[model samples]
Target: MAAASAGRLDPVDGRRTSGARGERVAAPAAPARPAAVRVRPGADEDLRPEAEAALRRLVGRDDAVLRDDQWTAIHALVAEQRRALVVQRTGWGKSAVYFVATSLLRARGSGPTIIISPLLALMRDQIAAAGRAGVRAATINSANVTEWDQIHEQISNGDIDVLLCSPERLNNPGFRDEVLPRLAADAGLVVIDEAHCVSDWGHDFRPDYRRIRTLLAELPEGIPVLATTATANARVTQDVAEQLEITGEGAGRSEVLVLRGGLDRESLHLNVLRLGDQPTRVAWLLEALRSTEGSGIVYCLTVSVAEQVAAQLKAAGLPVAAYTGRTDPTERESLEADLKANRVKALVATSALGMGFDKPDLGFVVHLGAPSSPIAYYQQVGRAGRGVDSALVVLLPGEEDQRIWEYFGSLAFPREDQVRATLDALSRGGTQSAQALETQVDLTRSRLEMMLKVLDVDGAVKRVKGGWEATGQGWTYEADRYARVEQARLAEQRTMLDYESTDGCRMAFLRRTLDDPDLRPDERCGRCDNCGGSTLPAAPTTEHVAQARKAMDVPGVVVEPRSMWPTGMATLGIDLKGKISPAEKTEPGRAVARLDGLGWSQPLRELFASTTPDGEVPVHLRRAAAQVLDAWDGLQVDGVVCVRSTTRPVLVEHLARGLAKYLDKPFVGFVGPLGGHEAPPRHDVNSAMRLAGVAQRLGLDLTPAASAGLAGRSILLVDDRVASGWTLAVAGRLLRQAGAGAVLPFVLAQQ
Candidate 1:
């Protein structure tokens, strides 16, 4: 549950009178008491009345009272001092239980509650709610680096009643070594918000969350704990509950009070539209937004798609914005505020905007592509209809959604061999940055970092001031467990597909997927497309479809050239480092479209699919390629050189020949691969490894006749696609060294 916004309290009744608009209302003063008296153990008296008073201040409502489940969770924490896991639907007041408990615990002379929140946005909302309740709250997150010293000072002085922090902070070198120990010892209560993240079975699992076990182990016995989430199935709930169990020699094993509620959202009217293609989907989305009641979110499966959809909506005169992981933190805050105030029609966002964004009156949620699992979809859609009586939830399932799911699945736990390699590297090298390790490991930076985090949690490694170091602890590969996880992920994907195609109740299907205890076999929302409730236009108007197609078809993504050589290239036996020389760099280039974009992405995806055989460029894409060259504003080239592709050599050659013919330039021989060396898959390796592989295999193999006029002539560097851009950078450097006056890189798609 998200926090209630700040509001004013009625002085006489201690009830909220008006919305304070996130202003700090002075909390009622507590009677002066000794700190020792406050810290004395569990509450022996009935705390319900006091808890209700705090709840009134929390929600700013005169008649605010806890649900029996919320009261039970609070009672478990305050009176029994037991660990508890609460799995309730969105808007069920989960945050209220913790915040109210914090108020009571603080009043009873306990140390500030420590909340392990996930997102920065959640932290902001939480801190505001704490202030409204007259509880002093502060946060330590990535965004508040400069204020850490002040916040720590506040905590030391007993000025803070609650501390909100991200799970990632638990493993920060200085924080882990310094503040965590003291926090663990002194914290009165520990609350894990969005607790599903603690379990690998969760749709949105984070390795850092596993560190909570160590924190739990260190906390003194009798310190109450609460773990809360809105979207956890029985499996994830059980896993999280088990993790919440505190085991110690003297304390034995503490039981966790599990409180799970139904996953139904009566306010959400669910629907699915099988809009045949990308253009039709976008067109229908445009029409829906125009007719929709209030501002909401349009979730895309990828960042590029969010931006493209947002752009399209804005072009059609809709007030819209894009929110994704790539969005700047400050700008995200601004956009969130815009959405909250109904200043915009919608925020076309990716999952980055998911988890804990608190907009109560949001009217609709539309998915441009279905999430890989029903649990994840439920979580995103939960952001809507929190306060309103009704909200529209629509899913436009795309054919590419499964392929995207597969792409993400590929980034799961690495093989035992890769794990051993990482361990061996750290065991030998005392401390190495992730960038340095990238040269030695064959994994991408993100995948490698994820592995290191998992290893850190497993005690196989430790993150220190400089970087990571091996802990010398014997660690098992757990290959079987990893395989099981992969299998489960595939099953979830299949279930999501089933959800898209199911004729039964959409809500019931999701509840079943989440193992909702209250789900009935014949349960039906009676408000979905399948239930004869609300529905959208069966198909988009031809005019809107034409506009969408036109906007998508006019595509060209700028390919930014690599400015700096990857670090630690020397470790990979390559001497390159620091910035590439300006003269040797390729000019800013262009691609017909991004591999993830809405327009040409379909055909490009098909043409480059793993199952698709290599051949000449398709006629449709050939025309698109010519259009890209024709639209080039100031491009001039005397010759074209193709990068030899180990996988798609024929396609690359054909593309190069076609471009050369279109440009009326000489097809100056290939940047042929070295015979003895084989390059690894580009997507699987980091920049250092990718660059080293390309540098070792590719060279300017111009014949004497082709090389005759190469000097002082511009060259168009051609390739099927660009992933890391390292290949083009290295190939451009080689061509420049061989006396090409200038190199301009071009590709069919930017991957």
Candidate 2:
């Protein structure tokens, strides 16, 4: 899924010699059960003419042949005529299935193999690897190439074997004009790597992934869609089939095969450690980094956490690297290389660390904190085993993770308003570019795709060859009903994780997640903290420490670090006071505020006292505003804001107060668009707003449409996560006609 690696979309090297990502996982040792499976009978056949020509174009060996399962999978992988499912695991050589299959197609015939992979690195690596194998695989991404012509030639011409692209790229002319017309009736396949992303039930929900369904719809029925990934449960499998329309009917051929080689690297000790304190856990992790054999991955819950942990790892004298969305493309690539080459022993990261990190033999996968579900836990920890050896997972979680998961995980679904707003926003201008849509949606891009796919299913929008367009229809009763039903199926998975956490059956629970139903109830096997009892198995709990009083920059008032437990008066608006920041322990009472609406919001300001801690209030601003400064930094965090919309006028008023300065105009009446609170509870923007303050205070009064200014001023649109931002988008447009030159809107985060 590399957006650029050499091996990804590697050129169709006629030989099925090298595996994907330098893998050693043997192609599922010839299938056990008999289905009269037939392999292409060509023990002594000459290479396809194209393949032979391709081999001559490169440097290495030729006559690459596929094994039985490899042969079947490859054909399935590259065929322009089948809908297939590949349920292979990490060590099962799944990548080879795609790489070889696509190559074979190009060798035997013509046309490009369009691969939709998960990571940019994976794509680059695939291209690099193919170049080595004598195949030419090129990746198109936000990096290097900025022009459309280059991509057009790369894919449209008969020369390119693979066009590694993202769903987000389909709208670009490089794809719509150059590759798409050729995709029809082309004798090649559309390989979707990390296919679980296509399913909403997948551990890591991606909105863009859902658009694959539309991509499939456009392709000639003969051109097959091959999906491959290691981490997928039952629900994920079903959702994938349904999304791809891989029905069990004539001419609509498809197969869901699971390569059940449990990714258990016995060489890499698997242990679970539990600590009662937070600092202790962080300290132990620091120790592990210092003592571990090689560079490793430290998984955290968010970008902020990853940054904090990276700092801690750095403070301990370790050459640490960090990877998160906040990291620039160049920095991320450099950091990944440093960690892989062992230049940096520890890399602190969030879910961004999940896919395409091909550094096998890693010291370990340390969970600085717990994840929301078991599937996520498996995928994160499974990062270790690679295609060869085993790996380790250190689930170091304190009471905080449990408390947070209990309160928020169950309700994480997208609200009806969020969904509608999202669809409406995406359907703008009757159609909007992916980039424009991304600006107004709240979920991650991948998750946003899935939402779009669902919207496509509903009739809210249609995924066109170049972008998204409104369809003037609703999702079919069947698809909507299916999504509604799948919601429970997905929630049950969370329920299972919770049950296992409570029951202390971590390994069994994880195995079950991968569809290994035969896994039986067993003892802790004396490997985990639960079985070890008082013994130090591994998980640690670090204490939440407040910034030192000396570090505090407050001039007159003392704002002690908020506790996990509630304090008096509950004026802060949530179930508890704001959680303590990692820097809170080192720089107490400092605060900072960040207003959205780039042009409208005031500049970021750090608040501190007149007296300085050391010099220049440490990082600027006085001690009096230091706490506020830090808090301000926290608010800028992408996913922090919860409520995405306001339904009540009073709630809108509360939002206006919070972002008053962000209100673009000098002084214009606010436009309040009521949010659909009746939507699904988990993702209900209203609920998130309630937690923020909208529900805690009095209502807001809306001015008449005529009274609200139009041409001369600006306005503010406040919502928790900014899903869609279209509930009042029309109203915003109306404001423009009335007088407002710029109707500025602010959402907590965009999709």
Candidate 3:
């Protein structure tokens, strides 16, 4: 039904007219019912025409019409002065609603709008969109730190209409302590883009987003707040609404209007193809790129895989680029512009390119491996078919998907002991830097900082000028909630597996998973491969397969040496500091593959998977190790020595013996740990902490035979895995001190 016929205003010819004008005049109703006289809210009626003009101007359309829900949301925010949450699907004009509302409110002499956006790409696009409507939008993000002063000046002078910022900025010491209060006091409207991120139940829960609750509470009453997201499930929606509700004077009294629309995207043709192995998947992707229609994205699970695929395609004479979190900011901008202009076949990317990237006529989206959740998949695929009639969406599920999922899942909320330890370290109420805290805690720097953010949101820790300090507040670790969320994530993984194998409509399955209002479970999309008979070919040509195999089989990844000694070594009773001497330092080394990579990772993982007892190295891995040696480009070592492992002693010895036999070099006896002590230290901390533990608990005693054979000879230091590179560093120093000419470190994999 047309929105106008559904008893709402119509936006036609840049004007909004009420539906009440067409009602027929009737005599006064019988006295059985009390005679009621209704009058339209004069405030909204006065601004409706201006809002329509703003919408028309923003979209560059003369006949633009705000749907029933869009107009309703704008009216509630601008006219009723209430909080609202719009949970519509992508490409549904969620931005238009907020921009129109900003225009309407600013026209009435209100303060500038404050939009808490999540991604820089989204902020850039929004600033441009607002400019078209003459909103004078300016963004303050990490990229444009130099312009913040001018932007703040504009805000103070009432020259800027809208200000965009990341949620992380809300907790920044300078912004929070000095700037936020003033902005909150005079803000006209607050828009939280990607508000689902605020809830732990959300698929992408960010601790920084939880700070929005404090921002909401600080806003003056009658400021009118708006939160918007397209990927929220029922649980996420309820949680976000509760968090977004106005809490002080009008707390819990006025309900937050949540407008949730359907999740079905008629323009997307969803499909899945199960491939046999990595080589086959790569070959199929190469062929698909050659045969596909227009510019699109090819999503991968890891940065290594994305780079590998891009290299393969470029080798096949295709213009492609690899984009991940490691890509430089300026390069990322160039890549986005290239993709927009169709300068490349496709961009092989990770989840970094998932949300808020706009390409109207994007032709397709293909996933080398499925995301762990259906919601994430839906959001990624929604990037395509936004302004086109039809676009292809395919998922090629790999056997390695589950491993990647588990790797990321391990980064969820910290364990109770870890959380408690952080609190205990900060209990003195004095500011301590992250490096100082590392001496007392066992968590890595990245993990510790993440936990601190969560603690800050829970009001147990506060980030001040120098660093962070405990607030002496009571905080409970919600074990049950974390457990439930973990279970939900696992269930989502299983659902994604089911989705790949389902015989029903793919779109319907996605909609049902999101709990869409108009889902028809029994209906087939008639556009997907299963229902439309357009399934991908089962195999690729022999030539393409050979090319893919060659690409995947190329081994040897660089293992850069550690340059500086870890900080706070004195606290660990070690005399190490600053730079390691050139005589003691190990040169750049080589590894067979990354433990998370695709090529030979499976067998390496299996070999290293055992923890109780070690086994002899397998024959194939031995051959691969020999291949790594042959492919190395640097000076050859004189002999081989193993870094003794208590848990994998047999495996390390077997590997060292086999490599010595293969290379026809002297087999130096093992550099075993002193005093029959076994195993490296517990590796649950940062580099400094790990080095401290290793130095205290582990030492190499040069056996008589090894000492006699090692003089002025380069030794190959072999270990099971390279994590943090501290083991290699310390062991290499010992070898150098023992009169070894040069030390070359080699590992099975770099985790």
For each candidate in turn, the TM-score is 0.93, 0.63, 0.92
Once fitted onto the true fold, the runs of candidate 1 whose alpha carbons sit more than 4 angstroms away are 1-46, 250-253, 678-682, 705-708
1-751: candidate 1 lDDT, tens digit per residue: 1112335332212333233221111111221110111222445346878898888888777666566667767877887687888788777678888999899889889898999988788788878888989999999988779999999999999999999998999989999989988987899999999999998988888999989988887888888999989888867877887787777664443667777777777779999988779999999999889888999999999998999999989999999999999998889889988998999999999988866888778899999999998899999898888777789999998988888998899899999999999999999988999998999999999999999999999999999988899999999999998898788888988999999999999889998888776677898889888988766655788998998999999768889999999888987789899999987999999898888879999899999888999899999999999988888899999999998888898999999999999888889988868878655456678888888888888877888987877888899999999999988998999888888899999999998
> Predictions ranked by TM-score, top down?
1, 3, 2
**lDDT of predicted model 1:** 0.84
Q: Give me candidate 3's TM-score against the actual structure.
A: 0.92
Best by lDDT: 1
* Total backbone clashes of candidate 1, pairs 3 or more residues apart or in separate chains: 3
Predicted structure with the largest TM-score when compared to the true one = 1
Better of 1 and 3 by TM-score: 1
The lDDT per prediction is 0.84, 0.51, 0.81
Count of steric clashes across candidates, in order? 3, 104, 0
Off by over 4 Å in 3: 1-45, 533-538, 611-613, 705-712
lDDT (Cα, tens digit) per residue for candidate 2, span 1-751:
1111333222222222233232222223233121222334652243334433433343243433233344444444443344666665443445555555566666567567788876786676667766655556777667656654676675656667777877666545455555566765573778888888877667665666666776676676566567777777766666675566544344224443333334332324445566644456666776666656666788876665576567656765779877888888878788877877889887888777656666655657787667767766776666574522334556776444553454444344455666777766755556664544544554544445556666664457766765688876754334475466456555755654463355464565566656643344662434434444223333322331222112222222212222232121143333334342232111112112222111111112111112312121122322223233234332331111112332333333444444443323233344332454333222332322322333232223234543443335434434322332332333344444454444334332232
